[model samples]
Target: MFDVVVVGAGPAGSMAAKTCAERGLKVLLIEKRQEIGTPVRCAEGISKKGLQRFVEIDRRWISAEVIGAKIYSPDGTEVTMAEEMAGNEVGFVLERKIFDRYLARLAAKAGAEVIVKTTFIGFERVGNALRVKLKRMGEDWEVETKLLIGADGVESRVGRIAGIIKTLKKSEIESCAQYLMSGLDIDENYTYFYLGNDLAPGGYAWIFPKGNGCANVGIGVLPSIAKANAKFYLDRFVEKLEIRGKIVELVSGAVPVYGEVATAVADNIMLAGDAAYHSDPITGGGIANALSAGYHAGIVASEAFEKKDFSANFLRRYDELWKADFGWKLRRNKRLQEFFLKLDDETLNSLARSIAGKNIREMSIEAIIAELIKKNPSIIELLKSFLSP
Candidate 1:
């Protein structure tokens, strides 16, 4: 019997397993894919602030290091936020395949057993312990574990089968599509974001530099207002930009825009990463959050195993730990997303023009909201919900 069985060998699963293994706990990490990071679904951009907090990123894993970001309005009004003002690289567009494999290797080196092409079918609870069911090479297998960590992706079957509410509301899901292309004559370092309903309703389009005239261009839209597939919108944008390139890769996926789930822990089970909805509501970024959550979950799972306590009350520590780390920031971002979604093209353009020379990072949340409230007093009521003590 293993001390902990981590499902999915993504960033979260790998981190969790590594953490547990480092604490001398027996860990088994399972992945359904033949390889860990093939058919990469992410646009591969991550904030430098988030990445530095967990692990020191190796330069080889980075496709390009971005120094700044340019936000464009529908009418082409642009606001450039530079790294000099933010005191960081804004973010790095990474080669996820290399990054993910490196994470899994770290876990394996820490003594966790890594298995690929192994699909988790379901689980059977036997009193206090859980028996995980899996399939590999058309053969059925079972692993009995003291704890289970679900680090699965957005479409998390482990959470559902484990009896967690896995349903995401229409507005909470961001339908995304991305393309890796070469021979594009664009900035090889800075990232670009286009914000406007006409370009991407209830979401945005991005161009993350990948060096050597290559880039990952993508768009995300809320399913509630997406009249066409995300790919359709992305194709239209690329055509409009008159980009001449050969498509090196095509990726399509969904990201949860909701904050972390309230019930990420249960008896003998815990959820982390996208499976637990630990994604940024506005940016649709989860890698950093996933790693953080995984690390906490791993630590908690190990402690619970040592205590021989796998009850929900014991596992609840993971929830508290994650909230202490990111709950307030997520809540603030959610409020910001609500305010942003209500703005039309003209209002957005006007706002962009107003904030043109300002450094957004230097401003506090209250300061930014105050500016918006001055323009529309009705925003005061919305801000009250988030600001209320």
Candidate 2:
């Protein structure tokens, strides 16, 4: 029996387990894969500040420290945003395989029982505690716990059984494919994003530098509007690149842009990371949000145990807390994402063109937006709502 059975050993799970265990709870952290953090699904970019909130700045897990981002319009115009202005998707590219392992090790260090190659099947209600089901080494297993945490990825089975998501519409999913490529000529200081309907349809292509002529080059496409799959656009984009490169690694996955769920809590169960649709609606970035939500989950789970209340009404504090933390940002970004998606390629080009060839490198992100509004007064109508509190 355990105080918490956190399924999936990704960033969210590891942090959840670690947080609970630190509070003296018996946490069992399980990863279904033979190894944790394999088959990398992320583009591996995170903000320096967001990352530092959880872990010390470790050079070992950092692939490269980027200074900023370069956004390219469909017509090939470039607009740059400095590190402080680029938001959460810029700053550092990570060696995710190592980073994930390090996080799991931290959970272990915190006294969580970490196990790999162990799958979470489901759970059954038994009084106030839950009987967590599992499969180890291809055989069924079980562990009774007071709480269950679903930190699984986008297609979360645990979330499904717990009724966190009903139907994930195609419109809410970003089908993404990425390749770790080397032998490419790239400005190591800046990550690059290219936008165009022809290039990526509803999504965009990116090149996040990883030092020494290597980068995570990828594309994400909204499946509902994409004529072809994500990999199809990725391949075409790579071929058209000015510099040829060799693929060192490849990864593909679905990212949920469905924003936050109605509630991430139900009785003895709670959801985190992609399971709770915590990825940013515009950028599909979740590492920071995962770390934040996981930490809160741990705190809330600890409080639940202390109060001796496991009911949903009691656990609703987790929902309230996460919402207080980053809920408004997610909701605002979702609205921004919706607005951006409605824009045609020409409108996107014009927006980028408005800021191109400017001496605004030192400007704040808000200033850059103001420049856009200054140049394209029409945009004020489209973005005023999001810009205002």
Candidate 3:
């Protein structure tokens, strides 16, 4: 019997498997895709400080080093900030294919069993253990483990089986489409954002540089508000840009910007990463939170084994750890998201103009909101509505 079975080979699963195995637990990490990290789902951006917190600098996985960011309002007003001042999605553009494999390799080296092309079907509670079902190459098999970690992506079946999360409303999802394009003229040292209801409708469009005239151009939209699909908006935005580009790759997926769930732990089970809805409400970024939650899940699971307990009470340590890590940030972003959703194109333009000349050199999401509360007192009523009970 394995100590734990992690369902997914993304950053969360790999980190959890590695930490557990390093603590001398028998761990099994499974990925449904034929290869790990194929069909990259995100914009592949993360904070420089957060990445360095967990692993050494790896040039092989870095596609570009960002220096700052630019935010363009609907009226074409631009607000620029240094990299450190922007949200968590501003530091680096990554080669996710290489980066994900490297993370899985860390798990393998730490003595966790790694399997690819395997699909986790479900799990059934059996005494103090659980029986995990998987299909490999059209064949069925089962494994017994003390606990299960749902590191799967959005709409995770494991989370459903564990009863740790609920189905998300379309409004809570950010439907995104991205294309890797080359032969574009850009600053190459900065990331860019375009914000306007007419442009993205409850979301934003982004241009993250990937160096050498290449970039990941993408758009996210709320299904409830967007007039068309994410691909439609993405195409419209890309075509309007003066700098023509050639597309080399196309990828699309959904992000769970639904904020946090009631809990991420159940008896003999826990959910991490997107399965637990850890993505940022405003930025749609989750890599840093995924890795942090996965590490905490591993630690809590290991401790449960040492104490010979697998109850919900014990697994909740995972929730506590992750909450202390970034729970406040998620709460604050949800308020920001709600407040922005009420603004029209003109209000956004005015807000941008107000901050265009301000020195937000060390601003983050919190700082940006503070500046708004300070300068754009016009929207104070709207911001206050979300802030109070």
Candidate 4:
């Protein structure tokens, strides 16, 4: 019997397996794809601050180093913000194919066994253990595990089979589509975010530079408000930009906009990364949170295995750890997302104009809320909910 079986070989699964194996636990990492990290679906942009805390980002994994950001209003008014003002490197557009493989190597080095082209089917509880079923090459095999970690992405079936709520409300998910294009003339060192209802309702469009005049241009909108297909909207925006470029790659996906899962841990199962809905509600960023949750879940699962207790009470440690790290911030961000959805294009443009000369990243949450309340007293009630203990 394996000490732990992690489903999915993404950042979260690899991190979980590595942590467990490093602590002397036998771990099994499974990947459904024959090869890892193919058909990359992410925007590949990550804030430099969070990456530093999770792993020592290898130099090769970085596709482009960003120094600042440009925010464009509805009517094309642009405001630039520097990394120094943001107190970080601003962001990094990663080469996910290499990065995901590197993380799997870390798990292997830590004494975890990895199986590719294996698809997890279901799980059966036997006495005090769980028997995980997987299909390899059209053949079925079962492995007994003391603990199970769900690191599967957005449409996680592992969490669902484990009896965790994986359903996302229409308003709580962002439908996104992106295109990688070459011959695009853009600032190679700065990421751009376009905000407005007409551009992307309840969300924003982004241009994250890759390298050599290449970039991942994408748009995200709340599924509830998206009247047409996400790809349709993305195409319209790209056309409007008058980008003279050749499309190199295309990616379509959904990002969970919910905070931490209500129950991240069950009897002998735990959910990490997107499986746990750890993406930021406002920005729809999950890479950092995924790694964080995976790390915490790994440690807690190891402790639980040693104690031979996999009950909800024993697994509560993972919940506590994640909450301590991200709970408050996510809740606050969710409130901001709600507020953003209600704003019209004119209001967003006016707000952008107001904050044009100001350093937005340096502004405190309370200060921003106070200004919003001053401008629109109707938002005062919602702001109080986020500010109040």
Q: Which lDDT value does model 2 have at 176?
A: 97
**Runs in model 3 with CA error above 4 Å?**
83-90
The per-residue C-alpha lDDT of model 3 at residue 317 equals: 83
Error of 3 at 289 (Å): 0.6
Candidate 2 to native Cα RMSD, angstroms: 2.5
Q: Is candidate 1 or candidate 4 better by lDDT?
A: 1
2 against 4, candidate with superior lDDT? 2
The parts of candidate 4 lying over 4 Å away from their true place are 85-88, 361-382, 385-389
Candidate 2 weakest lDDT stretch, 10 residues: 359-368
Model 3 lDDT tens row, 1-389: 89999999998889999989999999999999999989899899888876776777799999998877788998889887774533334488889999999999999999999999999999898998999999987799899999999999897999988777888998889999999999999998788999999999999999999989999999999999998999999999998775489999999999988876778999999899998899999999999888898899999999999999999998888888888898767776777788889889998999999889765664267667777778878677877778774
On TM-score, the candidate that comes out on top is 3
lDDT of 2 by residue, 1-389 (tens): 89999999999999999999999999999999988989899999887877989888789899998777788888898897774543333478999999999999999999999988898888899999999889998999989999999998787888899886766899998999999999988888888889898899878899999999999999999999999989999999998875488999999998898876789998998989988998988788899899988999999999999999998898889999888887777887777777788888888888887788774554234456677888988888879765465
- Residue 224 in candidate 3 has what lDDT? 91
Query: Of the candidates shown, which would achieve the greatest lDDT relative to the real structure?
Result: 3
lDDT of 1: 0.85
Q: List the residue pairs that clash in candidate 3.
A: none
What lDDT does each candidate get?
0.85, 0.87, 0.88, 0.84
